[model samples]
Target: MPDTQLRPLRAFAESLRLDQVNLTERWMRAVFHDTELSDADRLTYEQLSDHIPAILEEICGALEEQDLDQVEPAIERNARKHGKLRWRQGYRIDELVRELDLFRQMLAGQIVQFSESRPFFTRRHEERARHFIDEAVSFVTLTSIREVLTERDRKIDEYTGRLERANHELTLKQRLVGDLYESRMQITRSVVHDLRNFLNVFSMALQLMSRAPAKVEAALALANRQAADMKALVDELVEYSVVLGDNHQAAVECFDLRGLFDELVASCSPAVEAKGLRLTAAFDDTLSTIVSNRLKLKQVALNLLTNAAKYTKVGQVELAMTAAGEDQWRLRVSDTGVGIGASDRERVFKEFERATGDDIPGAGLGLAIVRELTRVLGGQIRFDSNEGEGTSFEITFPVRLEAREGGEGGPA
Candidate 1:
């Protein structure tokens, strides 16, 4: 008779002990099912269920205790680990909290269902079972929060550190103010392209976090990286305006063509992959170092590559540099992208003009920048294209720097 009286209390505790595997699976699915914490979808069932079974065991132990201290240490340890793991995995604090809150509700509801199903688990046992679940949940959430706070600095470091490369290199959507405003106008439009590109990535991240939680981690990481890119662009504005002023000469320095093209390949890889396009870089082994403005050279190469990668929806993008002749090297970028039309050819290197349709994303300034920079580096730029086939652009630069070459690239 006495054993029957204890049935209500021990029944819930015993159920937790025996049904932990199923309970853990339920909690894991709940996480996966949640819309706000959608990033959990990326995790495999095994990874998502880490430490859950053990945490349930601790909760079972806690339910049998007169004072909660007996089992809290174990719960705290596991809860803290879970928190750390999620934070490192790019979970927002609110998402983490929501995840735990859902578990607490699930655990509480399970107890209610158990008591209502069995005649022996009366109202008397129902209240006590709920109290134990509440205690376990509240304690677990508190421990998890403390661990999350401790790891917050790591996330901050990620934002302030060296910028990770951007996936889409050319988000070239900038609204020019109709008529060009000369040099200052050129400076403003130049940075507007960069700033807009970064914001586009951030916007994409927010959208993914809201609608497709499974992609939250990658989206957030990309946003974090672009934050640094924005900062760098801001810092460069002061110097950019000064360097490219009406009278000032662009700084000239020698740089290896091989090293520079490799960087462009890395930056453009993600965007190329998204279009199912193959991107390859090749330069003749005999090509030696070129004496030119490294900054102008990089900007020229980047603009051409970005334009090529962004417009080319399929096939491949290729960059190649080879020795053209005595003291000359030729750089070429070819793509199986939609080629420039006969009508589009007239606007190819004009400011705010594109060699493609209006629907495509471009600042229209990319080719303009490429043309001027190519001229300043003592290079001649030309291309051949067919409307449906693709385009090949080649720029040949003299190995020896010309005296007046540096002055040509400054603001028009």
Candidate 2:
């Protein structure tokens, strides 16, 4: 290779790199500034020039068929002589070919105009020049088309990726919705099962009370008492529904715990006597008033005493209350009955849960209601029991007295 031609080719390669560098800087600036670039920008800047061969074949078939002209021979020769000047410099080849085509066309036009003015060397030279110009134009057009196709392919790939991500997100959301629906259905089924048991118990009690009213008066009374227990169970279910349905807290007021216990004992005395269970109440009248829903507290105490009386047939059940601390009092209901198993103690507080099925005539809402009421009053209730011996429940509540000015210390 001659040094002269090699030096020019080297200079052209360097110039191409400089052009690419400048274009890259502009591309970065446009992206940072949030300026959108079009397909025309990609074409004009030669950004997608890698697909030049395919583009040239599509857009300029005449160039592929044409014999090597003087410029084509020179380009091939330089590519062979210097490896850097080969078609591997794809963008440079594309740009240079495009410029050559434009220049050839311009020269052909000038030659035709000059030949038209002079009538001597008329059509032949003009036709040959036009053919060369057409071939050059076709080659450059093909290169441009290939570049455009490459850009299109890149866009399609990006679109496909985005679509896949969207589908994945949709599937995740659908699974979450299905899980939520299943959980809701399970809760509904459990509630329905509990209701069915309570209804069956009420029906049986009503039928027994109607049959042999005089001859089995004691049994009838027991049946009626069981029926009343079912009614209370239903009422508690209603109350629980109301509490969970709304967001309102229970209305609290200062109340006498001792007085509340007195009312509960009086109300449950009939049931206690009927069951042959001895009932007793021991309290300190000096106990402070507790801040709570008075009606709910009374219901809790009544349920505890009834439960004690129901379980204990021959032994005594006692309701004892005393001041536990400066601002709290403790109430304990102890009974000598067939006590709960350790494993069943916690389960007893859940709705429709019982230690023994078909033995105890209860829908299992007593302890559940007790727990709910205690929580509503900001109090705590706990129990201790030995199976076949007895059980004792201790309840604690904060004190808030209204008539703390004057009161005698005595059991109500």
Candidate 3:
């Protein structure tokens, strides 16, 4: 309060400014040795200082001018920053408190050491400096803890909301699972019924051929056609079975992602050219090697490209591959021919289903295989179609597949 009271404190504050850098270094050295503050080791020299030099300047300003208002903003700003940074570095509350307390003790020691060296420095001057340091530390400590706790509360709220939303989604997924089970059972029944019908026709043709050798030619032809159809059906079903199996992941490899997609494009190029449709492919410049099931992914791209070519009467089949997000990639196969009918979209991925009708070749298992492979490779498949314009099947998957999803112990 008195001019004499302010003089020694101001002189000490000035002296502290001169040795500010050294003071910060000493504080950091003490912090590094403290067993309770392990997280401090992760911080660089600049970070560990926690802006102590700035805070000291503020303390000195307050002491010299004998006014706390001038330095309050600067101190509080530094404190908030320090707290937020420490929280991000994964420091616990106790560790934060202990670290700051160490800085406080260091400043307290500085005050005592300075007082001992100078004859003009008295107990009153020591009291004044100590009080200023104490006041500044309190402001910083409370503000910093508030910032950390506020951040913690916000994140907790966010996680809680996410959990609630996830729970609701899980419930919907369970219901969808039940529906899928029923749908699978229906597909099984449908396949069995078709097999039975084929067998009956084959039996009738055989009977006709045996009863009357005069008409054997027509009956034999019918029997042969029936046998071929049966074989084709069995073959496709075998393929479908293998594709839907869990073994697709056994082919996981970390290879050039663009190289594989480009290779797939090349594989389908001849066919696409034969159809008089341009086979165009676009890739992100950042496309690089990725970890995933290569063979299964190749199959997906091949099937999609083939179908795109098959369905397109004119225009081009386009393949676009790019990064979808920080850790995901997107591949889209689009056609410029007759797109899938809106009503038929639901059954497009169904076993023995075809949206473009019976004009195309092969069993309707192509799309089904694509869907299963997408699932096996941890991806989502969705199509955008305008009945006459075209259909684009876009699938987004992780850039790096986890070991379990990549089939652990399988060939990489």
Candidate 4:
């Protein structure tokens, strides 16, 4: 193909933002075939640069021998190249016919203006050109409308996907809020129930003091003890609330678990003696040290010991320690008291949940606080009990000296 002939097509393809390499190849092929195209036809095909190659091939093949075998192939090729090839949608075929008709009319007009010597021939060509132009224009318009609709549908799908994700997030947030509300309500009920029990005990002590002037000393002592218990309950409620409400860091320390137990036993000796309960401590001297929050651990140990002493009427309340594994030790506090029922075992660990019995006194926050404090110290607490027999509470803590140090430095 001559460089001059290819130049116009190349310039037109560039104007349409079509690839230069692809347009150059198509233009060269057309010019090399020695196709009969007038100056006006060539210029119009260049202006409609994107459709030039397919339009030319279709028109030329239609004018050839009437076998019509090449027609389907040519239509399929153009359709596939434009990504519009679909048997169910005949849009591409229609577009090809329309463009060919436009090309023929432009050719006819060029012949009429330049061929005055052959007026009859120019008029005949113009009539043929008009017929093809009408057919081609109708098809092109249909295909273009379909393309626009496809784009609109794609955009709608994208928008619908975004809406679905937003709705899913809203549903998740709603569920989380509901869970938070329920937990808050549970905590509130527990605090109120514990406070009511403390008030009842205070009232009983005051009445006892009023009825017997000779027993005033004993009544005042009992009242003071009840007041102290109430104060401890209030403090626990506040601490638990603080733990749940804020992300406060706990102070860590290394101490002897046996020593802590000894201190708690000494502090509660008066209560044990008053209740006429025997308190015994059997420590595994080899398994002593544990790194944890010293104050919290002390509270847990004292609470469990006092609880055992409070409920037991006769026999012994034993605090025993044993090695659980290579790096863990178990501390079991067993009491020969009115044991917990099977159904109440699990519930007792929850705040304000007490076994159904008339003799048991004070609020039911001791075991609950023990459970919470044990968890905070990175340990586990479990119990074994048979109603009318006895109850045993076992707590496990890591014992390895290195592990104890590591726990001291770890997050609470």
Best by lDDT: 3
Backbone clashes in model 3, listed as residue pairs:
none
Candidate 1: regions farther than 4 A off: 1-246, 409-412
Q: Sort by TM-score, best first: what order?
A: 4, 3, 2, 1
- Candidate 1 residue-wise lDDT at 229: 57
Error of 3 at 59 (Å): 1.1
Per-residue lDDT for 134 in model 2? 63
**In candidate 2, which residue pairs clash?**
55-142, 55-146, 56-142, 56-143, 289-400
List the candidate 3 regions with Cα displacement exceeding 4 Å. Answer: 1-5, 32-35, 38-47, 88-90, 109-128, 150-188, 208-225, 228-349, 353-412
Cα error, residue 355 of model 4, in Å, equals 0.8
Give residue 28's lDDT in candidate 3 (0 to 100): 92
Worst 10 residues of 4 by lDDT: 403-412
Say which candidate scores most in TM-score: 4
Model 2's C-alpha root-mean-square deviation from the true structure amounts to 16.7
As for lDDT, the candidate ahead, 1 or 3, is 3
Model 4 Cα lDDT, one tens digit per residue, 1-412: 4564333323322332333345334454443343333322333333435544564445334323222344645644453443242222333334434444444444344334434543333444444433443343333434444544565467579998999998999999899798678767866776676667777877887888889888788878887877777777677677556544434455567887777777777887777878777888787767767766778767777777877877788887887878897777887888998899988876887655678563455546677667766766667777899998889998886553233432232221
lDDT, candidate 3, at 43: 87
**Residue ranges of candidate 2 with Cα displaced over 4 Å:** 1-233, 243-246, 401-412
User: Any residue pairs clashing in model 4, and if so which?
Assistant: 97-136, 98-136
- TM-scores of all candidate predictions against the true structure: 0.43, 0.47, 0.51, 0.51
